[model samples]
Target: MGGEGENTAVDLTAGDPADVENDNDRIITEEFKIWKKNTPFLYDIVMSHSLEWPSLTVQWLPDVSSLPDKDYETHKLILGTHTEQNEQNYLMIATVNLPKEDTEIDARKYDDERDEVGGFGGVDNKIEISVKLNHEGEVNRARYMPQNPFVIATKGPHADVCVFDVSRHPSVPANNTVRPEHRCTGHTKEGFGLAWNPHKEGGLLSGSEDMVVCYWDLKEAGKTVAATRQWKGHTAIVSDVAWHCSKPTLFGSVGDDKQLLIWDLDEAKDAPVFAVPNAHEREINCLAFAPHSEFLLATGSNDRTVALWDMRNLSQKLHSLEGHRGDVFQVQWCPLDETVLASCSSDRRVHVWDMARIGEEQDEEDREDGPPELLFIHGGHTARVEDFSWNPNMERTIASVSMDNVLQVWQVADNVFNEGNEDEEEPADDDLE
Candidate 1:
């Protein structure tokens, strides 16, 4: 079945060592002649770039607390060119000066901890490092890459955090570089979520696709491995997990079974705080808590609806805002504004909804068909909107990632980061996916 050209003439395109060496010899001779003719200038230019290759993109994260009178740095983009690569995925943290101007919203007060070794990096697997951006906003760089990084969750130094790494290899694929790095038995299934405990020292929680949520303690040994307690309830795949910002004892998970299960990290109990079956009509793709409200939660689904629920009053639907005809992939509430919720859908639309205005105008005219009107429908992605994040440090800044391999930063309005009292505005009708 071999082609006739494969064994015959010198294949210039093939990567054979003999052929490549010959080609390099010929090119080197021609380059040497040109370099001799160019003289001193060629030597200087050739010696200039001896360090590293040029990167595709460069960016700086914004400082937030330095901004005047902002309670939370929701307007600042703390992560610069924050990319999550499939092969070498890393949470890169960088530090730089903020733009200086009168209207300049640079909050550099938190720049003292610009030290590395706090961000996460891993090769060939979804190994999330539980590192945080220091005050100066830099990542933790090591001489050699760390190993057995299963699920990382940050706590005070000494021994703090958890992470999961590839423990087994199935078969060598076309991409030979992506082989599994290790073989170990830690969790029952692959880890899906990691969160640091805000109240306790070296306390954290990790969830796996195995439908188990484990409480971990890393206060003993540096980079330790162990679980104190495990909580189980769901019979399906657990997709995501998150700790309640204020409630350290409680955490949440959304899964493939289209259910939302709330787990209490405290070992005093063996069951969930609350289990809501049929939470989403479809698979729950993403879930986020209201950064400012403890009783409020948001969930996105493949059903194209972003549901807002009030733990206080769940007798009926609080607000089921449906605009995207495709799956609503991810959702997050503004850290500074509990009423502002952002959702990215497979329909390629990133919508920002003002939950404070939900059912606020439920008159006979407006409630004829749908719920509250859309606050803003963000556009730009040429393909499905995979993920988007609102900067926790700046004002009204949002960054989104798409399947087109592009990331976009959009400023919604001038210092209007918390539009709690603004009138709801309906965007123009445009059917684009």
Candidate 2:
């Protein structure tokens, strides 16, 4: 692989100043002002990079210690990509240096400057290192352990999941014979998703096409991999899996069987604590748990919709968000805000939804039973967007990867509805069954 550096600037001006006094310009400017007044949220692409191979998955480093201490900063990210020429897959780690301000500024100050005269200066981004892995099939998912950022776990078209150590060096091995520290093999078919336990170290979860969720313990030193537990609850291929943010023993999985299963490690063997049969009309493709809530969860499905579920009640959904023109591939809850969610789909659009209005009463005339409120729509990718990740340490910052062979990092403005809104009450813990 090769490395290159580029500096790109963002233009946020509503219109040109040269035509500010013309009649036609006045009409256009007025229309633009009206539009801006109606639009609640805005986003600007801060950094973009075109990779040689189509990126399948991208993730921000869990720890921000490597970044500079400043109000606005930059950090590192890892990506998984595949080449059609050699049919080989590789892992890339990059150091992205975003534009920064000289002095500390509040959100209002930043917004005023951005709206008046475009955004901050250019961004400095380049690849730090690229290493080839020993995977013969395409890599579907890659993630870093929350407590152990140096260790990464990857799963894909093969049944086995590979764990690598990046603490030694970021580049390829000097001897060109680098192998994974651990090779976890248990599933009978290709793996589709991988997630690391957030509250515990050395705990990893993998969901596969074989309809099983395998948990691995990498703390064991002598063994290549220690398979501690495996759960078989889905009747079809398991598409995705996610561990609860605050619950150490709780995790959720979605599958082609159109079911969302919640499993607890302390429960009985091979059975879920709760199962939502027919969670969607079509196959469920992805799942994410709210970062701050104990019971809020989100699921994306092939039916071109995203659904919010209150785990306390399994019989009904909290909200159904419909906007994607194609199958929804990924859904993620914002780590900073419990009421915000992000999703991407095969339609090449990345949508951010403000879910605070889910239970609010609407005026009869204004409410035609429309879908959930969309905060922002991002459409820069030329091809299908496969996956995206939110930076846990940053507010409203997200990075998305696509089949267009590009990775884009951007930030969304705060929601307009959040200015003077009161917190919504949580649902009662009454059982829905």
Models, CA RMSD each = 17.3, 11.0
Question: lDDT score, residue 303, model 1?
Answer: 82
Residue lDDT tens for model 2, 218-320:
8764436756899989999999999998999999999999999999987767799899999999999999999888989999999999998998998999888
TM-score of each: 0.58, 0.78
lDDT of 1 by residue, 11-45 (tens): 35669889797885564445434322322211111
Residue ranges of candidate 1 with Cα displaced over 4 Å: 1-89, 94-101, 104-186, 313-316, 360-373, 415-433
Clashes of 2: 0
| Candidate number achieving the greatest lDDT relative to the actual structure | 2
lDDT of 2 at 306: 97
> Relative to the true structure, how large is the alpha-carbon lDDT of every model?
0.48, 0.71
How many clashes show up per model?
A: 25, 0
Q: What does candidate 1 score in Cα RMSD to the true structure?
A: 17.3
